[model samples]
Target: MASAPHSPLPVQLTTARPTVDGDHTGTHLGRAARRGELVRLHRGIYTDAERWSDAPPWERSTIATVAAAHRSPPPVFCRESALLLHGVSLLEPPRDVTVRTRRSPEAGVRRPAATFRRDVPPPHPLRHHEAPLPAGMSRPERRDALIRGDRGLEQTVLPPDAVPWCPGPEEGLRVEPLPLALLDTIPRMSRPAAVAALDSVARGSRLVDGPVGEEDLLAWDGFLRTKKARRRWESCWAFADADAESVGESVSRVLMDQWGLEPPQLQVRFVVDVDGGSRVRVDFHWPERGIVGEFDGLAKYQKPELLAGRRPEDVVVEEKLREDALRRLGLRVVRWVWADLRHPTRLRDMLLAVGVPFRG
Candidate 1:
């Protein structure tokens, strides 16, 4: 009666063992492709049509990147390509694939959907250098000279242990390790996006709905030394909350920080007397100001999994009631949707209108 929902999981051509090893006359493979039973991800990459159709843009790009990396004499997938492989979301996807090549490509050499760059290795801590002597060269001047001379060697290198191996039916694909990958990625992203990526990587326990343990905190802190931008990393880590439940919420928090607003308590639970007693969790709460903020993402109402057997209408009704119950306790409830996030100034103004104060 109705078509099946598309699956988000990626399907590799290697998984199509029958078609991969079966025919060469363009008979079976062509039929499958024509029938929409298979979708080509790249030149030699294919996935189940339904799965490819269902995946989001980022997911498809990620799959394609993986496929490209598996080609003969595999290119070192780096930068945004590596970020995708490591499961970090980007504010914007790269227009062309990025990879590390052994040497710089011929001048003006370009692929329609791929870009290449030469790799830089970590700088040696101690290296001899010669620089033109300035009259009365002070210690600071000498130090600057050394830094400039050793700049090339100061580049961070991916640790041998940190490379990620993505297994597929054909074999496995190698990617930069999470820590080094973040180093390359963070420098290319805005502060807020970088913070979100760091939070995601350090979020193993949160994914399981467990407490954010010291091990998780220490691991994230330790990884900071593997790259440059220690101060930026520290700023990101300082604002990071393993408790942030979604990307939108994480971005909202970063925006608040950028706007100099007081940080809201995340996912705070409230015990309501309504219906004899009920517990409700809000996305953000400013306890001192008696305010609660909710990021009304569409998925909460529209996604079947999130709806928990309830209709969209039922979710709307339930939320209205929850807001009313919250309001009854002298708490002001405010809500913003994805649209507000796009125009963040409007979101900030809305919160301020409700008496949310700036951080002093």
Candidate 2:
């Protein structure tokens, strides 16, 4: 007789659970409650030791997801769980799972110190993603089984004013994303932080045009609840003597403002009736000082009919063409790379040497 096909190795914990069907259960254990081929996790949870490696890292979190889905006392997956489900790059490393029960919070002490929460998700615009799974795999499986529940969470995007709380230095919690992870990690970031994050994105070969909708900015603007409205509106689209605004431009402005330097006029246009009637948009300009602070982000130098498919040297020439245009206008450009802002003090000094006064 042929043997039954074996389950994929549980890269995390061994389990009888089928990889996709989500089922694995034992009817009863005889007196003395003996078991076999055990792989212990925290407690009460175990992996069928036979096949452990096939499971991936996410599998470990599977226990939380399953427990969350089938709580006898329903749980809301709030706080850290809520943040995790929402894909917030910054979140607390989860320990004891939390839940809000429709019934009552689980009585008796659970080994992992479970916490009770109100059974509901927070408000909206903070989007949540719900996923369904098979029943039998709910609680019996270990971390490997945790991977079964799709990120079952519903959340509104965090409110802009929520000041993202994440792991920090000297703290032993699990770190979430690297200091600079996803390009949009700063979607709801505070102004100062957004400045830092945008600088990180700008340095990479990655920025695309800003997402057209102003919903996130609009939300943040309303929620700031301080004199920041003026600063935000001003910084939202900072003028560099005569340049249009992008996050890079805004960040450039913030650096100047925070450091007490002269802010440039934004999107100030200078027109010349060229041979074929061509028009142009510049990034930032300081007319009196004949200076322009240009952010050479991907857009300015990576267009398709231009550098996108060309050799990198060709890309350098494309940048030179733009620099030449500003030079023709008698503007002295102060170019800031992503590194300049990492040390704001030095950046302020650099500008000061070129005639701006930074009180710093």
In lDDT terms, which candidate is top?
A: 1
Task: Please give the lDDT score for candidate 2.
Answer: 0.39
Q: Candidate 2: misplaced stretches above 4 Å?
A: 1-190, 194-246, 269-279, 298-306, 357-360
TM for every model, in the order presented, reads: 0.68, 0.40
Residue 5 deviation, candidate 2, in Å?
A: 41
Which 10-residue window in model 1 sums to the lowest lDDT? 119-128
Instruction: Report the number of backbone clashes for model 1.
Output: 2
Best-performing candidate as measured by TM-score: 1
Error of 1 at 9 (Å): 5.5
Q: Write candidate 2's Cα lDDT for 1-360 as tens digits.
A: 011112222232222223345643422211111343433332233343333223323332333333233322233444334333333322113344433221122322244322121221111111121221123343334223334553332223232212222211121212112211221233344565455333433333222222222343453343233354445534533322212244455566777887777667666665533433345556666667777666655443534544546876776775577667766767676776556655667667767776764443
RMSD of 1: 10.6
- Model 1, span 220-289: residue lDDT tens: 3443443455677667767777777666777888888889999899899998876799999999999999
Candidate 2 lands at a TM-score of: 0.40
RMSD of each: 10.6, 16.5
Cα RMSD (Å) between model 2 and the true structure? 16.5
